[model samples]
Target: WRNTETSPETLSDSQLRGLGIVEGADGTINFESGIVVTGRVEKILRRDGKLMLIGFSNCSAKQGDRILFDPTWGTFDMAVGERISSVFNGAADKDAYNQIALVPKDRTIKVPSDENRKKLENLYAQVRDIRDRKVGCDRLGEIWETQQAEHAGDWLLSMQIFEILDEAGEQNDLKQKIVTFLNQKKLTNKDISTLIEWGFRLVTYHKVGLQTAAHGA
Candidate 1:
């Protein structure tokens, strides 16, 4: 059995490529494992949703990574035989299975619908916001460790900024934090830049952020 926590034992470059999941003819990425997350093709983004690739979001899933469908009574073992246009690896495109035409493993149902898309988006937004705050806290912690007490106070405020962001429920709400800083007018350009840089770095390194942007579903 493969360990999902640590990286699964390496399957070798060629072995991985040869796996039936590499890329499907109809873009229905079938894996050796039976987990599936589905959604509308949002836009395929690159480098973990930082850039564009074949994308999908707000759909359904099942088994292993199955956040969408629940195969409690049946299995997705049956082949549907529907053709997908383009197949790519990574999470962003996974949702495309809904927006684009797809032959499910069972081929019993058509791709997901707009209703599913919206529902998924709502979930996605909630999760994404949570992840973003975590990233911010991580960044603030890093900067805090390096600064002197004078600068430390502002960084401390940054931590509280995240608290407010958490309660606000949206990224736009971060404006209040920025305004608070501006009103105090205490932070230097260097400090501001450092905070922004660290925030991005935190997102790059944090698992939750990566999962949300990359997979969308």
Candidate 2:
């Protein structure tokens, strides 16, 4: 690897290929220059059963720039050595990559199949009709803090929605924030609906401030 003005942790073609940093494969994420990319480890060239070469399948990146992957699904323009370690070690908190989706280089359009749709529907149902025994009363307290009901019937329904998608790690963090709102005695059914709508909007539409205003904290 040619040593540039970049850090030693910077990714190389050989290293990326070893880690499966393909355009469509799933695995750790990093930056080449400034592009956010996924790294798919195909082989661990380890000696004595220890990991060595981390291969990649593809890289969904543009330039050979470098960026640091924040475990919170956020990225930093400048690379960080520790973050590279975290990516290789798999020590980053799971929720950090929650909001990240499978991004391909081609940016193709995909429609969910019936089975997939049904599965999503089931997840939605879980959030909507949360049972004490199912979702656990203890968990509800933690999930209520992130909900708001400014638009009437939003917060409550939103909580139900979160209960469904709680399996989604990022959404779970967001739900936990909502649950915290509930525990603070600041949530109402109306507020919940508004908050729920906002939550969905943020997830599906990516509207700015949707999550912030909902939390009210």
Candidate 3:
């Protein structure tokens, strides 16, 4: 981890790539004994063929501990206490160092069924039409992007788009579609509770807006 006092809260993609740290690469700190500490690499600093990994561990590590990089699960055996240096040296000798490059696992894109795809396309078209008619409704564009994200297997963004639509007083077919989507999803109890809370907030916001309008009139 970079120094919080000096470094920004988040770094750009280029900066992360420059550090050779793929955010969620799996690693382990193995002791000489049979004990193993599992962790995910947050940041890496490389200097003269040496690497310094900063990450959160399942348990505390003692000084002089080194991590074994295993981006692929079965690439390194923790029982053997294989360090990153030894793995890198061996790879260098074999001229196959690219095989152990730190990178995120390939994500399999979820392809929606034909019916769902048509529905999404229609929703996107409707949002685009609304944008073309309305001059300053930025939330519509955000809704379109969120819908695309949800279709791409990021269902968490649905709540955000829901809140945006509700706040914009758009309780039309688009809002209904979002509600239906949420209902069909396997949401946790906390997620359901949060949706209810957002509903209450929307009601309160509308009530406040109505009262303010009446007073102004």
**In candidate 2, what are the lDDT values of residues 1-217, reduced to their tens digit?**
2223444345555654565443345655533333454444444333333322444444332224222132343221222333332221121222212222222122122333566445434433444445433554444433343223222212333444454455334455656665565444233334323333434533442222334556886
lDDT of 2: 0.37
Tens digit of lDDT per residue, candidate 3, span 1-217? 3221213114344554554435566554433333344555554444343342234423222223322232332222111111322322211121111122222122132445666656555554554455446544555655656565645443434544454466567656666776666665535344334434434444455557666778999
**Per-candidate alpha-carbon RMSD to the true structure:** 18.5, 16.9, 17.8
Residues 115-175 of candidate 1: C-alpha lDDT, one tens digit per residue: 6434433433443444455544334333323322323222323433443344444454454
Candidate order by lDDT, decreasing, is 3, 2, 1
Worst lDDT window (10 residues) for model 1? Answer: 82-91
Residue-level error in angstroms, candidate 1, position 187? 6.3
Q: Which stretches of candidate 2 lie over 4 Å from their true place?
A: 1-10, 18-135, 146-161, 164-217
Count of clashing residue pairs in every prediction: 23, 62, 0
- Candidate 2: deviation at residue 66, Å? 30
Candidate 3 ranges with C-alpha deviation above 4 Å: 1-157, 167-171, 184-186, 189-192, 199-203, 210-214
Give me the displacement of residue 49 in model 1, in angstroms: 46
Assess each prediction's global lDDT (C-alpha) against the native: 0.34, 0.37, 0.41
